[model samples]
Target: MINDDLTHTPSTDQTTPAVATPDDRRPLGSTGLLASPVTVGTSGLGTPASADGSPAAGSTAFATAALRGPNLLVDTSNAYSDGRSETAIGDAIRQGGLPEGRGVVTKADQDPSTAVFDRDRVLRSFEESLERLGVERIPVFHLHDPYSVSFEDASAPGGAIEGMLALKEQGLVDAIGIAAGAISVMLPYVRTGVFDVLLTHNRFTLVDRSATGLLEEARSRGMGVFNAAPFGGGLLAGRRGRDGKPATYAYQAGSPELLAWVDRADELATRHGIPLAAAALAFSTRSELVDSTVVGMNRPERLEQVEALRTTLIPDDFWSDLEALGTPPSTITD
Candidate 1:
């Protein structure tokens, strides 16, 4: 069952100071847009119960705090809770009186059930997102989950990519990007050189580096690389469900091997007196290839903790040990 309080609570506190200053903002490639090294992920801020169906009493508070910070980038989607995510963000921006420098990155090209990737559908989706976000323009708009549509269909005449380009031409969007779980599907779009950014999740975390090559390719092309889900879903965050098992990868149940990997990571974290989630966050953001690390937070406190983790100094030996435990060699620097 979905938690009632998580979906509709807008009265959460907003007194917390912004996490970072203007100097903390990082350039998002050559787009001339600057983003916080840590971007707030609002997928969970939408109305659906989180994977564990827990109440997210802190979502509004988190959003308000994040918007007030120096690096103001919130990643949301039209499909998230049927646009609740965008609405919530819009509401927060108004309530918090966030400045104009704050930027929003929303997505289009959802699956067929939610949206199609044709020119008309893409245009309609962007319009809806603009209304939901209460903004005349978006800094970054991505073609979300392109793996759901054939590459041929998406790149052909009257395709979604073409529609996005049109919006850029008209100044509706500052930059365009492709975000997806499947590297194979997103890489083709990156190679097109039409996109200014790329967002890859799950495949580039502490326990997984399958997207390392993809990151390298994006970097070589001077595309901004946004790394999402640095905690491997909720596993590296050390969140366990009522079932007593760790939250699975991408919200599904974990395989035995995956669970075992988490077990070892947890043990190592405990030995060092560090939160496993902190280690995971630090590991994901350490790479120079990553222009920004996006983490999903539904609570104000969790957002604060993440901000702390970004600048937290983990001992070098801890990183060496963590790397020894099986992070992909390709992703290791020094």
Candidate 2:
């Protein structure tokens, strides 16, 4: 919910049919992962349905959009809002009458400090997520927080990775993936090629380019890559929008370099006559390294930010201008 737009509402009625094919059906990227170029993040879509607690307008807007065309990939986690996000997505799926074409991606969290791997923990976590989503099987299931755990343990005989693979084999999941805290954490798995997708941050994002190698690895292995946090937690989008504040409220005090980057981003937007969010979205999708850019929506109006994609696209020069204003890859000064 932190990065979501806040003016949307949720629906409680299940009578409405929420399935409609959009005119646009495109592959996510060269990676062969088919989906709408614009994927919806369900992080905060499940909050209170309405001010009266009937249904949230935000949820209805997303459901409507999903019904329109955008592959509608909803990402959630067992740990997000103590599992309310998933529960809310489930409620919205039922009440809004979402269709089967929309895919759900949910993560599994485990304590890294525990050297011992537990299959029961993995099963329980996935089962709870399925229950919250009110789905028989999640289209995509990921091994969340794949940090600190050894690859052997991660893919061991009875580890979480193995459990997920079992689920995939049993048809409980269409595909299995690894969502790490960083791209480096996903490298070993990428080499294994056992996973179909890799969801991680900081590799192709605003502040980092360290994961370029990982992207190539995934491509070589014929796996899909999703760039998370392309905005660098809103640092890349710069400040100010129709909302009148920075995209992220979580950052109260930022570095001097960060502020300067924000200023330059705004300048580039002004010069190119494009929105900062569009620039960021265009940047992420332009890269062969990224299959999809995950954008979170909490309000109905927030969808307007991305709705531009339906009609407008940023020019290549917008990216060139942004790169000129951002930190150099070789320089870690920021």
Candidate 3:
């Protein structure tokens, strides 16, 4: 279940990659890539503003800030908002060029309408993503959401796996990996020992830890792990969402019990003079299993806020107190 409150201890193994720091880049497994402790996620930037087909307001501005900010990586997918997310990143690059040594990681997705995940479609998807992003090559590419096809089919000779590997063989993408929501599905891909990176979101945050086993497994195989949504979709980050209807987790309504846990955690954090989000974010960044933590910064104004929170120093006693409260029960399993 996603609501697992399993605690983690940092790895003792010397070969484990360096933990990402606020001011420096950390290695992404052995892919010869490096990224900041925090990576800007762009799923929200591609939201359709209206029936008129205009991009959301402030999307480009936010992208520009992220591109020029301290972050060394920006993560997106071809399936996000039917490819508008890449367009927004591209526009941001054109408006204010990507900073030196920073990288953009994208994924190859199946055809939306037909659900075709073959080599031909993968090739087409990569080309289209490059065109939309106005880039000739990508640093890391993934086979996203392979549930459309069984593991057997995806690993077939002419399947999407071949397509992603071909991209790496051709030097079009520096690294290749799997990005998916289901832990069961992702575990299989990670066990194959072919992927260089692994991206899992909404499962490694403070209130939930369904991705615990997955992260450990991936790291043991020498794969970089990106843990997204350290805020648990904003509940663990704050008491109430912008809607003021209580915070939500995993895209569903936060249960009263879950809200109560947040309330208790909030008081605990306040008593220690720290915002709750700091603890939430630190949970991911401090984990030995995680190489990078991906957070959503969809607006220009949020860049500074996230940066501040990313660097906040919470007392160790506060973590002890927060842990004493225990995690909320799973009401919305991923």
Please list the residue runs of candidate 2 whose C-alpha ends up more than 4 Å from where it truly belongs after superposition. Answer: 1-20, 28-33, 45-69, 111-117, 240-253, 309-311, 326-334
lDDT (CA) per prediction: 0.74, 0.62, 0.78
Q: Write the per-residue lDDT of candidate 3 for residues 1-334, one digit (tens) a residue.
A: 1121111121122221222224878999889999888888877565655366644655665666667777889888887767777887888777566677877898888898899999988999999999888889999998888878999998889988899889999999999989887888898899989999999978887788888999889988999988887877767776365566656787678888888888888898899999888888898888888888888757654656777887899898987887798766755465
Off by over 4 Å in 1: 1-11, 14-23, 48-62, 111-115, 244-246, 327-334
Tens digit of per-residue lDDT, candidate 1, span 1-334: 0111111333357575654555576789889998877887877584554465432445556677767664568788887655667777776776765576778899985544754668777788899888877789889999888655688888899988888899999998889999887777878999998999999887777777788899999999889989988876666777655567644665566766777777887788878878777788887778888988888766666655677777777777887787677743222121
- TM-scores of the candidates are 0.86, 0.79, 0.89
Of 1 and 2, which scores higher on TM-score?
Answer: 1
RMSD of 2: 4.6
Best candidate according to lDDT: 3
The lDDT of model 3 is: 0.78
Report RMSD for candidate 1. 5.0
In angstroms, the error of model 2 at 77 is 1.6
Expressed as tens digits, the lDDT of each residue in 1-334 for candidate 2 is: 2243222455434344435454455564343446655566665655654455533444544555544334457677776655667766676667655566677788776743353445656787888898877889877777877554677787777877778778888988777788765455677777876788877663465555677777788777767667665555555555434354433322334545555666677677878887666666666766777776666665434455565643466777776766776573321211
Candidate 1 weakest lDDT stretch, 10 residues: 1-10
Off by over 4 Å in 3: 1-22, 50-54, 239-246, 332-334
